[model samples]
Target: MSTPEVSGALAPGTHSTGAHSTVTAPPEASTFRRWTSRCGWALAVAVPLWLAVGRLLTDSAGSLTPVYAATLAPTLLVLSLVALAVPARRPSGYPSSRACGILLISWGCGIVLGFTLPDVGEGASSVLGSWAGPGFEGAAAALSNPLGIIMLFMAVLGCVVSVRHSAHGDGSGRPRDTEEDEAQGTGYFPVLDV
Candidate 1:
């Protein structure tokens, strides 16, 4: 007697089953995401390098300038972008949550340090204090100056860009697929006898 065949759907151990059961994998991370991630890593790496080089190369007069403090915003922005872009190899809630928390903390620290530090200038501090609140009023008076204004603006812009970029995925803002999966594949239909 002949074995009964499954109908309409694929049967086990059949080539048709294998073909029809195929699954399409998710898409890889987008270029934008990758760029953001790399940018973050670069920023994190560059800051220490700058500090080390500045210490070794610059004299006291040059070292006192606000340039080092001014780099805070850009560094934080890059680090945050990196946290958002780098795809995790394995599923873990902690990594994502920790990353986000660190990003926020870094941004906050950058803004505070950039604004409150003595090198930033009094005039710029005053403006920031007036808008942000009284906590910065004293520093504002100390940091006021044209250069300080420009640096403050740049810092704000960096923060805004980093926050905006971190909210979305690569180009289309879609979630990236796991690296292990096949993002593109064909579907198959099979017929079977009852």
Candidate 2:
């Protein structure tokens, strides 16, 4: 009897009952990749533009310069996203939940790093409020934007979300990395039945 086309893998010694075999269906891909790609592209463009704006505005002393840390923070996230492009260069081929997870964490780290850097004059530390304090904005005053604020929120949220999500996950709401059984021979992509 001809075997059935299975979408999920059949148990060992379990044969399809005449064209009724269960084919193991590969797990669904993640949507996080979508957000990752979007965020990366956005930061890549926005960060540079903002940096330029910061330089232009801060041409003179006490002219409202952007926080150095802010520029540095988004740059790290942009680079990470550029490399991963929503988990992997090709989203459909492989779901790099772990890579994506790491990138998310990196994004959060970048945010913290940005804040840690000096927020005063060129190479000045803001920990002591180099300029004056809240009363003294300093030459390199912090710049704010709707996009930037959103990005910051996203960074924190990404970190929180990644606690459960992982690269090996099927994104089908199943336990993460349990799809080792889903992996086939060869590279990162799961082997599809031809």
Candidate 3:
């Protein structure tokens, strides 16, 4: 007695031996995921160095205050860690939930920082006076100040990039993958079937 042929359903290198067929497991991680993880690590290392350089340039003595390091370093570290933790691929959808959450959090932080932290430059201090208070005026001042303005611009840019990233599954910022491409090529595995 003969069994039914499964047609073109077998994997690229899978060989059918009688009735018991061996199937190959998919890859542990996609190329995109691996790259994203690597990038996260790179960013984790680079951000502190970049911030330190900026601080040195800004200060005449090139000395870092303990308070400045304590506050800013941890905030940046957490943000970078969050970037590392976010998955490379997400379902195709408009205005990704994760992206929106991050944007909101950034906006809140920017506003709070504007209200609390003193302006750095003499020009900024002269223009935007002290706004530390629990009032609507403080919020308005936060939106108008230089730091707040830069933060708003950055948050918007992040939103646009995140939306684009969410639209593509592979996180390549490209169109969807096709089935024909998958079927035609031999993936990472070497073909064992003749």
Candidate 4:
């Protein structure tokens, strides 16, 4: 009797039984990969939450900056969406280079928007108050505020990380060949008996 052929990968000793064939799943990700993936997901989720809370606080304090939101919120929303869309794990060396690049650029733009956009009118206070003190509202102080400095640092860090991930593939050097079994002539492609 002729045996059936199965497409794709099969575990060792796996065989077709009449009409059914067993295929093994890919190997589990390493602990470090899993942890980093979770962290990425968590940070993606936290961005929106942080934005909402900041808005709420400003609204409550009667110092809401709609102009800032109009310009900066959209940028932040784009950043969050891109971050979420980025895959936590890719197929070995086939990293999400394009997505990472977009993320890096968007983050840099957001930082620039935050710094250059004018905060006019009655609600022009920084999160950490004025750099010259709570009552001082000078342009130099506004531009050199602690919050802006912190944001610049964070944006730089995020860009660096994205670049590294795109180039290094999770810092694991080159990607492994996932088709090792097939390369070794072990791919099960049994022909079905008539």
Local accuracy by lDDT, each model: 0.40, 0.43, 0.44, 0.42
Model 3: clashing residue pairs? none
Q: Against the correct fold, how does model 1 do in TM-score?
A: 0.30
List candidate 4 stretches off by more than 4 Å: 1-33, 48-55, 58-64, 92-118, 130-194
Report residue 179 deviation for candidate 3 (angstroms): 26
- Residue-wise lDDT of candidate 1 within 38-125, one digit each (tens)? 5545555444344323322322213334465356434544544444443332222112322333443444344444333332333332
lDDT of 3 by residue, 113-166 (tens): 433333344322211233223344354445545654554455555455555555
Relative to the unseen true structure, what is the Cα RMSD of model 1?
Answer: 14.4
Model 3 bad stretches (over 4 Å):
6-10, 13-24, 28-31, 60-65, 78-194
Candidate 4 structure, TM-score to reference: 0.39
- How far does residue 36 in candidate 3 sit from its true spot (Å)? 3.2
Instruction: Please estimate how well model 4 matches the true structure, expressed as its whole-model Cα lDDT.
Output: 0.42
lDDT of 2 by residue, 82-169 (tens): 4444334332433345545555554543343332223334644432243245433342224234334544555544433333233333
Q: Kindly report which residue stretches of model 1 are placed more than 4 angstroms away from their true locations once superposed.
A: 1-17, 47-115, 118-137, 140-194
In model 2, the Cα lDDT at residue 40 comes to 53
Residues 1-194, candidate 4: write the lDDT tens digits. Answer: 99887566656645555456454433444554455445445544444334334434443222345544554454455544444344333433221333344444444444433333333446555433433345433553455455444544454444444433433334333332336436656554334110
Candidate 3 to truth, TM: 0.34
**Ranking by lDDT, best first?**
3, 2, 4, 1
Instruction: Evaluate model 3: give its lDDT.
Output: 0.44
Error of 3 at 156 (Å): 18
